[model samples]
Target: MAEQDGAIYDRLTRVPERDWDKNAGLDALLNGAREPFVLRGFVADWPLVQAGQRSAADARRYLLDHARDRPFTVSIGPPGHDGRLFYDADMAMNFRTGTGKLGDIFAGIEASEAQDDPRTVYLGSIDIPAHFDGLDEANPIDLGDRDPLHSVWIGTRTRIAAHNDFPDNLACCAAGRRRFTLFPPSQFRNLYLGPIDNTPAGRAVSMVDFDAPDLAAHPGFVAAMAEAQTVELDPGDAIFIPSMWWHHVEGLAPFNILVNYWWRDTPAWLGQPQEALNHAILAIRDLAPEDKAIWREMFDHYVFANDGRVTDHIPPAARSVLAPLTSESAGRLRAFLLRALNR
Candidate 1:
């Protein structure tokens, strides 16, 4: 429990190890979670996690033995930069990045006492199959019909600022440990979002520094953190983060490695809702306030509510655009939107 000096009543709800299994219980929670919760022994048996139980060096060797000769991009920052990677005053990215051999980078990590001095040097997302051949065989988890998009993240004592991902993520702490402070998407307004087009860690991150809060500068972050749920993970534990949930990640050990499986709940035919949101910002953001309110109601009726009664008045045969979206209808709608945008 990473609580304040004498604070009581941890914000996160923790469920014990024996309560949930990986199949139905885990799937149900991932599908319909309203708040973040921790499953105690979700991945305690992974070989990587087992190696980590011995020592951090042992875990590093295990992963390195499986890796290929592929080069990986690394993020580097000076010691005492306090672990948080972000944009500096000049709007330049705080951390420097370069590509190098996986073995060479790991050697550097092993040689340095990163926890004592604290430099940010890590690989963000290395494709598991591409870099570590047959690694998935060592640690298998069922994602069912959806073949997950898997990646490996290895780094030193570093912190990734609050950010949201597009797909649902299952992050397994295979080596070292981590603490995740998560907030719901509804707190987007209070999170102090950065530039959408340019980002440090491949996504729009929050400007607020949770480790050292500048309360005067970002007053809204107080509200956001108040709603946050913090979960500390040891090696072998895993967390399922639903899509669009904002999370700030901290690597709690000198050398850290995590494997993540990303998948969408919806079928492949459905387009990314974030793309539609970007288009909406372009088309509807500057409208008159009254017109904006009317459009909001229209959107609620069409997209949010899913109220079949509103469209029951129209005959099914005549309901072309408003019909239930089957694969064929979705394809037609996509084509129609493309044509409209092209004009």
Candidate 2:
């Protein structure tokens, strides 16, 4: 019950106690619950067979056997400087030594060393049939040519700072537990994002510190912390974190194993327009406070019009620009933007 961080972390309150058959498919679990939902004890059919049974030795062997053959990248945590830790590039490089054995490489390492090691491992395009032997069908998610079923081994009690990914991710634990802190899109203002356009891999600054955050430095974080929600996941259970929701994950136990599936939606490309809106904010909206205020007012007129007749405000000539999306129409719009940019 101890609160170590600024955010509140707790276990699943409503654990389903029934022991249903282990071979149950994921259709019910995936489709029954709506978006932004959490379910306890949802285990994947294929991986659950070897769950808790796979030893650290087996995992190490698997990683070494596949390291040179695949597009796998290892994250060995970050580096330490003046007692404050940052991601280290050297430790990540050490994985290349000694055929990458877990015991040989990670033995006698302090928590700070593990945290700074850049050996964060990611196996890209894992062949499903090759990885998980004797699986009938692929999980509904498509992970390119790589296996949709993948595993993540967290060696230390590591912290994954706040960020969001493109696809909907379903993370199931095979060993140990993890604590997840989540915030909806509306809470972005509270999250205090570092850079609007930087990739997640490149973001180096953390928005908030749970142990001892400087309230004076980040005044808005206080309001955001009040609205945050947390969930702790146990072994044999899974959590679905939808697209665009900011999440911060912490490995609570050592030798943790997580198998996750990342799936994209057909309309996943909606973010392109949102990215354009962000660019518009930078190019036009942020130029002057008065112009920003005017743009906000106009946006309200278009988005919040109760009469459902804001289309009336658009001029006849500009009507085509706002027309419904079609392949041909989209092409014309792209051409128009290109011409405008070139001019």
Q: How far is each candidate from the true structure, as Cα RMSD in Å? A: 3.2, 6.8
Q: What is the Cα-based lDDT of residue 180 in candidate 1?
A: 85
Evaluate residue 257 in candidate 2 and report its C-alpha lDDT on the 0 to 100 scale.
57
Question: In model 1, what are the clashing residue pairs, if there are any?
Answer: none
lDDT by residue (213-268, candidate 2, tens digit) is: 67888787777666566777777667777766677666665455566676655343
Assess every candidate by TM-score: 0.86, 0.64
Which stretches in model 2 have alpha-carbon errors above 4 Å?
1-35, 48-52, 62-68, 78-156, 199-206, 264-274, 297-321, 335-343
lDDT of 2 at 6: 28
lDDT of 1 by residue, 198-315 (tens): 7897788998876667879889987887777777788878887878999988888788888898888677788887788789888898999999999999899888895886679898
lDDT computed for candidate 1: 0.80
Q: Which candidate ranks first by lDDT, i.e. highest?
A: 1
User: Model 1 misses residue 271 by how many Å?
Assistant: 1.4
Count clashing pairs, candidate 1: 0
